[model samples]
Target chain A: MSTRGQTHLWVVQRVTAMILAVAVLVHLVTIIGAVRGGLSAAEILGRTRGNGAWFAFYAVFALSAGLHGAIGLRNMAAETIGLRGRGADIAWLAIGLVTAGFGIRAAYGLFA
Target chain B: MAEPASLKVSVWRGGEQGDFARYEVPARANQTVLDVVTHIQRELDPSLAYRFACRVGMCGSCAMTVNGRARWTCRTHVRKVVGADGELELRPLANLPVIRDLAADLAPFFDKWQRAQGRFQPKDAPDGAVPEDFVVVPPASKARREADAGIECIGCAVCYASCDVVAWNPDYLGPAALNRAWTLVNDVRDGAHGDRLDAVAGDAGCHSCHSTQSCTERCPKNLDPSSAIAGLKRRLFWDTLLGRR
Candidate 1:
């Protein structure tokens, strides 16, 4: 990858990390609130279903996690396993795409 | 006075890949690690190759992986770094391609310096008027002190050799380049602040740093290049937001 593209990835990783941080906290709090109130999975789904804000929040969370985790793993693989260059780049892109697809599918299942 | 005890040294021999050749030399009081290497080359094996210039540590040519750590051989006392049994394992620095026995290729290491725009770029020549006196900088300023702390790098690749980032990403500018950029960023007289910052802003630049702090730990000058790079990142973020870049 070009130096500029590499740098952009670095910046994107950090920005995604920030997004994940907040999303994770909110997700954890929501879970605790639901469990403490003794709400069933059906009741939780009732509140979340057809909610645009919930869909958007979960979508962003999943996308950020996929991007951040895949990039981080890509770097780790390069350093630890000597996986680098175009092959590694393509592999990481595949990993990110698969992760985002599965994550968004799960999030969609929660709403639909 | 009685003669000092001998030090059994195992120095790496050959190029790129090599094995260590053992040599026994008499150790003197107040002897440095460089002294041991020099004695082995001169007395035992003339074929053994190594690099060094100033014996007092001014020139950074004497840096080597002594006892598994990158250090200035001239300044490193054998007693301090050697094993408890008084044996020394000397080899060339890591990450860079080795040229010969105890001499790694420095071309890639130095090229990053230029890539980072480490050199000072003047804005304009002093026309007829003597350039309005020296630019006064207060020592107590936080930015000035932070800059001064990492400014004393003598082009030694000690920090560069010790860095993990350089090992992982070959294109990464390494610590010396980033550190040099940090010094220039703090320099009030340097005209290429914006350009320099832009040069060091991206991935191969300051953002590649994982902050392992190996550079700070290995620095004989005790300069913290990692912190300086972080400062550059913070400054660049602000600059980019304010349209300063």
Candidate 2:
């Protein structure tokens, strides 16, 4: 990867970190409130199903978490085990794609 | 309170594959760690190898590991580091190749400095003639202040020795070099601003800094390389966003 690519990753990491900061807080609070209010998994899905706004929100939340986590793990892998360069980049990309894939699938499942 | 008659010192004996050699030296009032090593080299064992110049702390030539911490031996008094049992352990600085008893090979450290583009390149006129007019920069200007904040580095490499990132990644440019680049990056008259920023943007450059503040903690000059590195990160972040690089 070029230096620009690394810089892009650095920026992406920072921006996604901010997204995760808010997303995680909202996610935790909402989940806690919902579960404590006696909403089961079926009731939660029933409330979220066919809702475009909820689908978009959850999808963005999941995507941001996936990217944020992958970048952080990429850094840890590089620092702790010396996994870096093109191979490391491709590996992390695969991990991020897989995570986003599953996350979007789950979000769609909840919505539909 | 009475002082001990003699102190037991354990000095590294050889290069990469060496062990500590024990020696007893007379304890004195207000003695530095360098003084104890000198006593061993001069009176006890002439073969003991170490490096020191300008017995005062100005030159930064006498840095060594005293009791598991990188420090300027010339500036570290015995009373400050001596164990409760009146013992001192001396070795070469960490994160660099050990050359001998108390000297580390600084070649890699200096090479990374060059790789980080730590040197200044003065801006030149289009006609390639030296400008006769003096470039006046206000002392209190933000740029000059940023440059001044990191300009007191004595090239001690104490931060390099103390950095965990350097230990984890040898290719990562250590704090001193990155801090030097930060100073040059903030120089208004510097011609290589973009080039220097690019030089220090990637994995082995300023991005690798973990922001542990170990450099700031261990610096003998009280300089904050950690903040300088943060400055570089902000510069690169903006440059990347603005497509300036």
Candidate 3:
């Protein structure tokens, strides 16, 4: 890979990390607020469902988590175990799919 | 006169497949790790092999694992390394091919240096004019200051041996080479900036370094390869985004 590509990835990874920092914090705070408001799952779903705004927020969270996690796993393989090959690439894709699948599905379950 | 005593030293005795052979060398007031190895080779075992050039620290040849850390044995004092048992354990430099006892093949270390473009490529003159005799860069310039931080690395494998990334990733260009590349990249006279950046940008290059600071913590010359690697990463980040490369 070109240095430019690698550098771009570095930027993407860090930027996603920052997004995740904010996203996770917002997610936590939202959950705490919901609990403090004594909102049931039915009530939470009633509030979140058909809401484009909540859907958009969760989508960003899922996207950031996927990008951050996939990049991190790629880095871990390269740096920790020295795994760099077609196998590693395929593995990264698989991990990204699995992680994003769960995150996006839950977001859809609540917001869609 | 004082009581005559000996230092309990454990010297590694063979190639990669070997164990530490114990020796009771005559302990002196100002003994160094190199002195112990030299004494063991000369007096006890004629077959013991280790490399040393300058008895002083100028030559980086005598680097070995004293106790557990990579050190230039020529400059490392015995008093500094001896445990409570007054024992010293000597082994070949870690993460290298040990040709024999205490003598590690540094070819990989040097090979990575070339891979990192650790050399000076002169810049051409502007407007098709002849190249000047010299390029005047200020001593206090940011580039010069950054370059100066790592320019003093003596090609010693101490940093290479200390790097955990190298231990995990054989293809990763180790710290000494990357540090050299960093100095060259910051050099105002150097022209192969893009090529140098590209060389160290891939999976097995600068980005692979986990910033463990092992190289910085153990550098015999006190150079911060961790910082140099960071500079390389930051430069690559901007050059990549700005299309400067």
Candidate 4:
């Protein structure tokens, strides 16, 4: 990869990592609290469905996770299997697209 | 007085496909790993091929893989590295072509250093200014401090030998080279900042480091190549943002 491309990918990976740190904490806390509070699925869905703020939060979470996982997957293949060049680039991009597709769909289903 | 038992030393005796040649050498109190190698070469087998200069730790030529770790053999005392089994193992540095029994060819390592532009380029001395006119950098300055961090490298391939990145990717510049480049990047008197940053920012450069800190762990000089690589990353981004590169 070119210098600029590598630098941008590095920055994106770090940024997504920071985002995931907070997202993961919020997600774990919410789920644990809901279970402890005896909130049923219907009751939980009532608050999440049609909620703009919740949709936006989950959207950001999904996108950040998708981007972060793809970059990490790309690095794993490169370091472990010596994968590089255009093929590896395309593979990571495809992984990112599919991951974001599913994640966003799930997030939107629950809230949008 | 009771005589101490001899150390069972196993030295690698050939190229990549070589077998371990065992020998029983009389141990001494201050016997170093290099001293054992020297004894094996001088007394046991005159045909043993190894490289060393300035038997002290100043010269980096005496480095070898001792007991599964890269180290400067001269500074490594047998007492410190001797296993409970009263044995020692020695081999050529890993991740390099073995030119002989204990000396891995350093050409590839040096080539990577050159690839990373690990050299000082004077901006103020185009015509080679006199020593009195040299750029006198203060010791407390950031540039000087950063440069000092990486300046003690003796070109020992211990860090290179210990790095898994180099083992995984042959094209990677390894830690020592990138660390040297990071020093050059921080040098205020050095004019080739953009070129140095460009040389060390891509797949084969600082970005390739996984920050596993294997280099920092195995470095005999106690230098941190991982931190240097991080510095390079930060500096490279700043340079790009400032339109310096």
Which residue segments of model 4 deviate by more than 4 Å?
A: B1-3, B124-136, B237-245
Clashing pairs in 4: none
Candidate 1 lands at a TM-score of 0.87
Give a tens-digit lDDT track for model 1, residues B1-245: 33348777888888876798888888788789999988888888888778889888788888999989999999998778766566889999888888888888889989989988898765453243435567778888876887788778887799999998887778788888999999888877667887787788665689878899999899898889989888888887666556565
Order the numbered candidates by TM-score, best leading: 2, 3, 4, 1
Alpha carbon lDDT of each predicted model: 0.83, 0.89, 0.85, 0.87
When candidate 3 is compared with the true two-chain complex, its DockQ is 0.63
Rank order (by lDDT, best first): 2, 4, 3, 1
Tell me the spans in candidate 2 whose CA falls farther than 4 Å from its real position.
B125-130
RMSD of each: 3.4, 1.7, 2.8, 2.5
Tens-digit lDDT track of model 2 for A1-112? 8877877888888888888888789889878878885878888987789999888988988888788889889989988988888988998988987898899899999999
TM-score of each: 0.87, 0.96, 0.92, 0.92
Q: What TM-score would you report for chain A in candidate 2? A: 0.91
Worst 10 residues of 2 chain B by lDDT: B125-134
- List where candidate 1 sits over 4 angstroms from the true fold: A37-39, A81-98, B1-4, B125-134, B241-244
What is the lDDT for B129 in model 4? Answer: 59
Expressed as tens digits, the lDDT of each residue in A41-88 for candidate 4 is 797888799998888888889888888899888878888887888878
